[model samples]
Target: MVFRRGSSQSWPGLGGGSGYTASLGMLRAAVLLVSLPWGAQGAACANVSMALGHRGPLPGGRYLSIGDGSVVEFEFPEKSEGIIVISSQYPGQSNGSGANPMLRVTSLDTEVLTIKNVSAITWGNRGGFVVSIHSGLPGQAPLHIQLMDPHETPPVLIEERRDFCIKVLPAEEAPATRGADQVHFSENPILYLLLPLIFVNKCSFGCKVELEVLKGLLQRPQPMLLGLLGQFLVMPFYAFLMAKVFMLPKVLALGLIITCSSPGGGGSYLFSLLLGGDVTLAISMTFISTVAATCLLPLSSAVYSHLLSIHETLHVPISKILGSLLFVAIPIAAGVLIKSKLPKLSQLLLQVIKPFSFVLLLGGLFLAYRMGVFILADVRLPIVLVGLTVPLVGLLVGYCLAICLKLPVAQRRTVSIEVGVQNSLLALAMLQLSLRRLQADYASQAPFIVALSGTSEMLALVIGHFIYSSLCPVP
Candidate 1:
């Protein structure tokens, strides 16, 4: 329904009391043009009778237009150069029950002018504004125009309340202010999760398993060849193929290379026990693989970098790798030695420290989660898709490699898990150290989408452990 105040169908202008009551203020030569953010065109205009001038007689009533809305024209004696403002209001218009009229200039041949801040009565007012129009012709017909709400009775103004006409002029110049906002990207969050995922889990797990098999195999040349094939050939090839298939980014591919290069995980013995694999074999292989990884990881990184178009030197820190080995290996070797000499004390110590590894891993994962998402966002989609596909491929490649080497079924399963799962934590630590040294802006975004890649791997490990236990139930 349409509503307005101070009008009867045949009452003419008699309902409106005086000329001052009906008079719209005239525009003087002293014109001020204000530029609004909404207008791009060079026009300065405002609604003259847009605001409530005074209250009207009728409060709430509806009517339909008898004809096209009345057009009150203003004569600009000079060439008036400015935008035109058009407005409509009903006196005693409260509870915001009146429709905002669609206003336009018939003279300018333009569509209806839009009014801003004319929504519900806020601060007890509804006002609308628009920018200026340049070069308004001299002796123009109407200085102001009002289009009645098409939904209401037309004739523009209610015959009772006073109507208005305004004259506006142009500003000297327009300013260079347009579209100054913020910059955004699509994949920023994904990059944050990549490094930790690639370096921590995959690198660590694979290194441990490969080394375990290598230790026993390396006692003779035949098995040593098998170990070499598993580490360098099968693993690298699988990674490369997965990257290609998944279309990973160069950075993500580089991350995968780093994972493939890192040596054995420190927790192979515990992981083996949990997964029902051979603990002794896992430890021995872990030792052998850790030693070999310092060299192999660098080589693999270099090759993968070249293939992925990454420009880094792909230099694995042998000294750091050795340092890690010493830190981890010395304590374990000492513990084993002490166990042989004093069984009860050694057993007690083992029990006491058994929880330490898990505690450390938990802390590591937490830190990684906080930092990893930032890196993952920078990771490209190609790299992410490729990285996701790698685990499944690694599993298949591991089984094939084991079969080719004539390994027993149980050993093959162990090797396959080892190959598929890696100690990405180690690689991530090294990457962090490297990033620190390089002083690059190496971060992704917040609220990372896949920052829990580490956690996912942990869940996968649990799944693997349960599956293995079910497959090979204890006698």
Candidate 2:
């Protein structure tokens, strides 16, 4: 993954940018929304939350200020997802309501959700409410949300809307969210310099690969069927299903799609070694999946297009594909030459590098976390659950497939590991590159959350296997 410098304005409400939200008015309101943390629509003031020693409970979200009573109307296309936060007082205030606030959200004269007098559920702002929504069909005009007094006459307080207003934008124009503020990403120099090491660490493991084990793959290709089916068919669909079930934002859902569609991670061999699986099979599967990814990745992505709820096709980066091939080939080739020329050195290198791969894997994770701390923190529970389950299910399916084929125990373990640990690095790389070409900020977040969860789950599997191996007595 590549990293670069970034700059951003801090959002007003929520702390971390976790999921997605409709961004129809995001860019415009960010300027004033954060500042006016309290008051009715069309009102303005300074940011009061900054003085609370930064230990703020305010979930990051767009904030709007209204004078006494006013209505804020949002005009956008269909399939939008977002959050509308109505704060009765400044975010920093720990007690009571900010002048008894009330709001009624509507779309096309129909009330979709309501925010009345804040209850204890509103935390400190006892009279405020934070609500999320998914918009309806595509219409020529916009949908409207009104803020009014519970004791008012027409229920429509003011005829005007202001800069700090919150509106749910269309899905494509907005992001799917889990009731959190939009994340602010600022680049880290440490991330940029160390990110490429992830690929190098992965390739180092490939250096120990054996060409003889690959010959079996060439001769009997039946075992390859399970890996192919699981990568192409089962995983991607599972991610889609999880996204839908959880009502996840569009971008995060798509991120899960890309990750599930990806091939086995480069760490498959290490996992196989840790679990006493067939290292040869692990390496072969990783290589084959990486090679086939050029065609299947896009195809898998297209297969779920209708469900994506997106109008534009994401551009696949050719350079990332070629880079995957190059990284895989060069290190293995060097390792092969080293083994052929100096057998003793090869043994020593393997002993040193085998465990080193795991260390580098987590080190890269640290780099990634430092690079996009808020993005990782912004990941919601649904995405996390799906990410963990996808690989675990892949492992079980792979093991079942291997058993049906009458494969040996070693091969079974290898296939299981290979199927479970997808090449999250490549998926992340593609997501970072593809998202730059798209208009949605949440899209970038989707893949990232999947990557984080996927990687963590794989590590958990490895550790669980280690504990199991230690407890079981050898024959």
Candidate 3:
């Protein structure tokens, strides 16, 4: 039952040859000498054809015309099973009495498709085989079929077919008839619970935004413009480049691109505050970038998805975008009003806002860890490596761009943190809303990993900055 690749050993006992090698020349010569046509050799086993279940033969015989190149493809839905019937016109010739040729089928990519059972049929000198194929993940792999002479000490491949391929398509999803305003949170219960808390944290941070600082930035808008350019322009391109450089799969690449295309995360202002950056600029940039995402997110996603050859109609959740904006805007407006009207209450909220944000951060990390254990269980090393590098690249690009524009040091730090920390939750929501369950869950790994990486890296930088400041007090 052992199959060897590139073995030049002869296939003995064919065409009256005592020890005939199964080389192309010898096989062709035997066909000519025995008056057996190439298609009829191996008792017509060479003229192979396949079909799904009991259906008619596929269009190109053994060479299916389903996809390009030498491979012919047949697709099976994920987590489903199907029968592939492989038949030849004539029965395989027996080496001796009551001996039938052995049929072996193997799936080259077992992760995508599994060959459960291979059943052979031989009656009245007519032979064929049926293969039961089970689908796994959404992917494609070559299926190898071998008609071997079992009479030999070791099975010798009589007629081999490698052109047939199996593709596991993503499971079909029922059309979503839900209205734009309606939201579904059926994917992950933990994430569903955490969403409200996350938005609440964002609202709390909005309370800390200083209106005077925002007014000054509006008067001189270079820092704000620079932050937008880094957040929307540079980060998406960096993500696309990284996806290509790492040769990530289409779904993973799309996930990374979507995450990068998103706006600044809710935590950016906190990071800026802790790291001696301009907190007002951080909050302003976050708000502006989020509003910009209404148009820019879909544009960037479309460009990159087209490049990745993904044809799925990815619908950007406009309601979600508008909701995010409302969450940010209303809270900030209320806070500004409170600051102007209830000065004492505003002062109290500002004093406790930093500690409240820290608590929310710890809660988010705990929730992310719980979800990461599920989403990232099978995450590959390349993706983890790429995810780790993405935020760092954004930080470097934003910092360099700020320096080029001659922004103040505090503004540079604010821009860097804003650009580097993406709103991965928005990306996650988009994916979950747009794609099927399995695909959405699978692609979600990118955002989750990126979120964890950015948080950890920014925290490390904040700690380092704190230590340096403590050691060398600035008088």
Task: Quantify all predictions' global Cα lDDT against the true fold.
Answer: 0.43, 0.56, 0.69
Superposed Cα RMSD, model 3 = 10.1
Tens-place lDDT per residue, model 1, 381-406, is 65555455544555566668778878
Model 1 clash number: 50
Count clashing residue pairs per candidate: 50, 27, 1
After the best TM-score superposition of candidate 1, give how far the Cα of residue 439 lies from its true spot, in angstroms: 9.5
Please rank every candidate by TM-score, starting with the best: 3, 2, 1
Q: Supply candidate 1's per-residue lDDT for 93.
A: 24
Of 2 and 3, the candidate ranking higher by lDDT: 3
- Model 1 spans > 4 angstroms off: 1-227, 349-363, 377-382, 429-455, 463-473
Displacement of the residue 48 alpha carbon in candidate 2, Å? 35
Relative to the true structure, candidate 2 reaches a TM of 0.61
lDDT winner between 1 and 2, please give it. 2
Identify the superior model by TM-score, candidate 1 or candidate 2: 2
Off by over 4 Å in 2: 1-207, 436-441, 471-475
Candidates 2 and 3 compared: the better one by TM-score is 3
- Which of the numbered candidates is closest to the native, going by highest lDDT? 3
